[model samples]
Target: MITITEKEFKQLSEYIKINYGIHLKIEKMALVTGRLHNVLIQAGFKNFTDYYNYVVSDKTGEAVTTLMDKITTNHTFFMREANHFYYFKDNVLPYLTSTVKDKDLRIWCAASSTGEEPYTLAMILDEYFGMNKIWWDTKVLATDISEKVLEIAKNAVYSNERIASLPAHWRAKYFNKINNENSVLIDKIRNEVIYRKFNLMEEVFPFRKTFHTIFCRNVMIYFDNETKIRLVNKLYDHMEYGGYLFIGHSESLNRETTRFKYVMPSVYQKI
Candidate 1:
């Protein structure tokens, strides 16, 4: 196994932080080296420095894309955080139904890794709307920094075990068995999510309209205080007034640094 030297680690860490707002500290050296070792060899690089150089020099941005996919953690499963979904369905949906005059609900899953979180949300929306789904536009915009995960999410296929935690009725309705009992998202549910590759570190968000709800769960744990504050402000700017923001239960927004009104642990509302 190839090891990353101190200088090589600094170079790669700085590059990732500058480009993606992910702060890799010395403690994560093993994590970085372990995840990126195979990537380094497969990309024809003998060492970490050479891999870093190649990633920065590649004008097409594919190298960086691949690098992000390798370094970042995309560990998520269906209904991983079930309480958020329950709150959204029971409280947020009712609020939106009455207040959103346009009847267009724009929800953004900012770190929708491998389709589970966004698809779970979509299924909740489907169940909520039921017979009146045609009267409202409820498609979700699911984005992630890693193209690898985006590709997987777009494919909407998973092992049966991956979806075992989902409700039995939801499992029956939104997914179908394929390739010997592997679950694949049914077309109607899959079509409700639009997956895109997005870098959260971009200085300015390009969306023409604000979102009614945003799920940026568990992704900010890698960012530093400054980066997290700046990103939270950006999200605040792009959210509709009174819109909801759901983050990982372990993540929190500093009351002084963000404009979002704290509603509960891991949940906020645009003021």
Candidate 2:
């Protein structure tokens, strides 16, 4: 395994955050070293600095996106937090439907690594709202800084092992087994989600339409307090009044919970 010097690690971390809004935790040093060393070897670079220069200066600029996808920690599965989904279905949806006069529901899955989280949200929505119901009435916008994961998300295919945690009924309803080894998200459910590339640290969020809910879970644990506050505020800005924001169970609001009153554990509503 290759070792990343402190200097190299700092350089890589800062570059990633500047380009992707992802703060690499110090513990991720091993992860970065393990994942990036092969690419360095493939590029015939002797050290981290050489590889960094090549990545940043590449004409096509695809290397940076590729790097983001590789290094971004994407440890997620369907229904990872069963309670949040339960709350969303039982409490949140009914409330949003009754209060929001538009009758259209929009959700943003910020930092939606790979596709599980956003697609899972789509599955929940489809289960509640008819799959073929008014197309314009419900939509999910899923964005990640990594174009590579976005590609996987668009494919909407997963191994059965990856989906073992999902409810059997949901697995049966939303996914089709392929070749007895893999499963693919049904087109109807997949079509309801829109995937794009977005960086959270951007000065101005470009969303014109507000969301009924936003899922940005498991992402802030890597950020510093200042970055976390900025991200939380930005997410709040794009949410409608009474909108829901779901963070990871292990993460805390770190003094910024004032903007969003805690509704349940790991769940907040933008007040």
Candidate number with greatest lDDT: 1
Clash count per candidate: 0, 0
Q: Candidate 2: which pairs clash?
A: none
**Ten contiguous residues with the weakest lDDT in model 2:** 129-138
Give per-model CA RMSD.
1.1, 2.1
Model 1 Cα displacement at 211 (Å)? 0.7
Global local distance difference test of model 2: 0.84
Check candidate 1 and list the clashing pairs: none
Best by TM-score: 1
lDDT, each prediction = 0.92, 0.84
- What is the per-residue lDDT of model 1 for residues 57-100, given as tens digits with 9 covering 90 to 100? 89999988878888888999988889999999999999999999
Candidate 2 similarity to native, TM-score: 0.92
Shift of residue 212 alpha carbon in model 1, Å = 0.7
